[model samples]
Target: MFKDSVVIVTGGAQGIGKGIVHAYARQGAKVVIADLNEGLGQQLEQDLLAKGYSVLFVHTDVTKEEEIVHLMQRAVEQYGTIHILINNAGKFQHKSPYDVTFEEWSDLLHTNLTSTFFCAREAAKVMRHNAKGGAIVSLASTRAEMSEPDTEAYTATKGGIVALTHALARSLGPDQITVNCISPGWIETGDYAALRPIDHAQHLSGRVGVPEDIAQACLYLTNPQNNFVTGINITVDGGMTKKMIYEE
Candidate 1:
């Protein structure tokens, strides 16, 4: 469905973002991976190229506006236009609210929340000129609506992403650009083999989610036929949020 399409994914070096990069590339999209991790990003670029996939890795710190501009510029220079953008770069913090300094809070906000807005803005500039418009999907989390201790900063950024998705959808709707977010839960990016059966049982789907699950959601949201479903947040959490637990 994405033949020859130009797709740019921020933080597309590892974890869930890596899954997204592979998904788009497999569908024939010219994928541009924007990430700060040079090692992972460059390695991924080489690996995908080995499979004959078209991809470029741009070392970027999403929290910096200048780097984002450069990332977009580089993509447009190479691909001529951008058809899809996936904002997936973010930081996680777990400091207690009391101990969280202004610097820490501000840094997290810039990394997680501010970067999303700027990336969308820059991408939308190139997208607006497309004949059929474009699509943007961001990585949000279930923590946006629910939270645990020492999650204030992360939760706030996620909630902001949810809100930002709808707003961007409205603002860019005139140009036919669609915006959306996916909220994932318990996506075991590490050591899936180490998880006990009880961990899998916690989810209503009878298993934990993998990066591929969210990658599938991204494909659905950015599909050319599914533009009607914009400005919404899709929670890909294996129905964990729906489960009501009680003390045994």
Candidate 2:
């Protein structure tokens, strides 16, 4: 569906992001993997290239704006211009609100929230010039609305992404750029074999989610025919946010 298009996935070297990279590459898009892990990033690049798909790994620390600038430049240089951008780069932090340092909180915001804005902005600059425009999807979390103990920092940034998605949608509407986000709940990036029955039963879908689940959602939101679905946060969880629980 993404034939000949240029797709950039931040944090594309591992886990959920890696799944997204594979999804786009398989659909015939020129995929750009942006992340700090040189070893994994290059490995993904080589793996995809071996399959005869166009892929490039750009070592990017999303927290750095200059590096973000370089990332977009490198992408365009490699494959004309960018068509889709996946803001999936982020880190997890779980600390009590009382103990979380200001530096730590600020750093998380820069990595998760600020980078989302700037990356979309930079990508939009190139995307606007195209007649067909482009699509951008940010990764939010179900924690944006619900909360667990000592998750203030991470939850705050996710809520910010949910709000930011619609705002950017309005701003970029004139340019024909569609902006949306996905809130994934309980996506197990580790050993699925280790999860017990209760884990699967916790979700309405009767199973825990995998990276490929979120990846398919990204593909749906970014598809050209789905431009009418912009400015929304699509929850990809197995109805976790809608379920109610009472402590025993």
Candidate 3:
């Protein structure tokens, strides 16, 4: 557990980000929910506070460097120090490589790749000074390894994140900061009732992944005692990545 630790989760208002936020809050960490959606962010903040968990929601567009800097400043001001950062603020949108505009491609790169670097840079600034050091976990995707047509933009950024994770881990090793990335596959953020048989059968684990599967991995990677596990990519995709595909 993360008792009394200060943790920041970008895009923490919904989906996998929300699950990670809840997991940390349940373990007594003072969590900063940095998100773009004011309504959902505030609601989640209030909900956690009602349960007597310490949390603060700061509306932040992570693609902008200034907003990210301000968000970190706010977190440190409130919590005194940052102990962990989960860079999960990203969108999955794809277009045909032939039809993707320059603006669209730029936006995708900024959102998924640039934001990851900025957040880690800012968090490491604070963590390096802390005596206990800190940990960072980023969200990549399984699409980075295997992708469908027209997924070039999304795939490129995810692949970038995996490389970024290892590079950052090496740079921050002297400072005792661990950096890691998680690549998730086929995680259905919606109702489990809607899944078809193929969805269940395709994965070697016999089911598609849920947010909690990734969230649990987050907890393990960022745990202070697990300092030995760093610079690695954990694929929480129910063995789908390892399975071979052929026409039946």
Candidate 4:
């Protein structure tokens, strides 16, 4: 569905980001992998290229504005125009409010919240002018609404992203650009074989979430046919968020 389209995926080297990149590439999109991990990013770039897919690895630290600008410029330079942007570069560290220092708090905000704004701003500038406009999808978390212990910083950033999604969507709608957020719950990016039966039973879908779940959501939100569905947050969490969990 994304043939000949340029799609930029920030933090597209590993985990959920990697899954998004794979999804886009498989759909014939020119995938740009913007990430800090040179090894993983380059490897992914080469792997996809070997498989006859078009992909680029641009080393980018999303927390830095200049690097983000460079990444966007490189994307346009390489692909003519960017059609979709996936702001998925974020770090999640479990730390209590009292345990987190000022520096740590700032780092989390810049990584998760500020980076999203910067990337979206740069991408929207290009999208607004394109004949097809564009779409932006940010990776948020279920923690934005509910929280576990020692997750203040991560939760706060996610909540900020949720709020930012609608704001950007409303502002970008005039340009035919769609902005949306996906909040995934209990996504097991690690080895699934390590998980026990009860772990899967805890979820309403009878299994923990996977990165492909969010990847599909991104595709739907960015699809031109789904143009009317904007400024929304789709939670792909196996219905766990709706189920009541009472301590026994």
Candidate 5:
């Protein structure tokens, strides 16, 4: 469905980002992997290229404004215009509020929240000039509403992203550029599976989600037929956000 479309996926080197990139590629979309991990990003690019997929890897620090601008420029240079942007780059750390240093908190905010804003703003600029509305999807977390221990910074950034998604959607709606947020629950990704054992019953779906689950949601939101689905935060957490599982 995305044939001839150019899509940018931040942090596209691995995990959920990789799934999104592969999904777009499968749909015949030209994929640009914008990430800071140069080695992994380039490797993914080469691998995808070998598979006869159109892909580009741009080493980008999303928190850096100049780097974000360059990322957009490179996408335009490679594909003429960007039709979709997936703000999937983020940082995760486990730390208590008391133990979290200022630097650590700032870094999380920059990586998770600021980067989304920077990328969205730059992409919106291009989409506006192109005179064709584009879709932007930001990856949020169910933790934004529910919380675990020692995740103050991470939760805060995610909450900000949820709010940011609506604001951007409202601001860009007049231009037909839809913006939405996907709040994923405990998805079983390579990193998540390595960090903890999967418990299917923990969520309402009787299992944790896979990266493809969130990617599919993103594809739905970004689909050209989904014009009325802006400003909404779709929770792909297997109904975890709706259940309150608190032990007293």
Candidate 6:
């Protein structure tokens, strides 16, 4: 459905970001893989290109304003305009509020929240000028609603993202642009599965989520027909948020 549409997926080299990139590419969208990991990004680009998919890898440090600005410029230079943006780049290190260092807390906030704002600002400028408008989907987490131990920084940043999404939606709606956030819960990525096998099974689905589950929600939000759905934080947590399971 995204044929010829230009889509940007930050952190598109692996995990959930990779899944989103593949989904958009399969639908014939021109994809830009923006991330800090140059090697992985280049490899993914080459692999997708070999499969006859239109993709580009731009080594971007989302926390840097100059790099984010350059990434947008490169996207426009390569594909003319961006029709969708997936703000999937984030950092999640476990640390208690009392134990977390100042630098660590700052890094998490900068990477997860501030960077999202920077990229959205730049993309909205271009999308407004294009007059066709665009869509933005940010990766949030269910921790924004329910928190676990040592997840203070992550939870705080994710909550900020939900608020940011709503505010942006209100401001950008006048320009015909839509902005939303997707909150994933207990996803079974390789590292996460290895880290918390038991907690992963506590979900109402009796299993953890996968990258594709979140990607599917992203596709729906960014779809051309879903223009009316904006400023909402859709939770893809397998109903975990609905249950009141207490851990003793």
The candidate scoring highest on lDDT is 2
Q: Which stretches of candidate 4 lie over 4 Å from their true place?
A: none
Off by more than 4 A, model 3: none
* Tens-place lDDT digits, model 2, residues 80-127: 999999999999998889999999999999999999999999999999
Q: What would the per-residue lDDT of candidate 1 be over residues 103-212, giving only the tens digit for each residue? A: 99999999998999999999999999999999999999999988889999999999999999999999999999999999999998888999999999888899999999
| Tens-digit lDDT track of model 4 for 1-248 | 79989999999999999999999999999999999999999999999999999999999999999999999999999999899999999999897778899999999999999999999999999999999799999999999999889999999999999999999999999999999999999888999889999999988899988889989999999998998999999999999899987899
TM of each candidate vs. truth = 0.98, 0.99, 0.98, 0.99, 0.95, 0.94
lDDT of 5 by residue, 1-248 (tens): 89989999999998899999999999999999998999999999999999999999999998899999999999999999988999999989898788999999999999999999999999998887656689999999988888889999999999999999999999988877999999998777765545433467667787778999999999999998987899989999888778866688
RMSD of each: 0.8, 0.7, 0.8, 0.7, 1.9, 2.0
Candidate 5, superposed: residue stretches over 4 Å from native: 191-198, 246-248
Q: Name the Cα RMSD for model 5.
A: 1.9
Candidate 4 residue 25 C-alpha distance from true site, Å: 0.4
Residue 213 of model 6 has an lDDT of 92
- RMSD from true fold, candidate 4: 0.7
State in Å the error of residue 87, model 6: 0.3
Distance from true position, residue 48, model 4, in Å? Answer: 0.4
Candidate 2 lDDT trough over 10 residues, lowest sum: 238-247
Q: Cα RMSD (Å) between model 2 and the true structure?
A: 0.7
Model 2 spans > 4 angstroms off: none
Candidate 1 accuracy as TM-score: 0.98
Stretch of 10 with least lDDT, candidate 6: 192-201
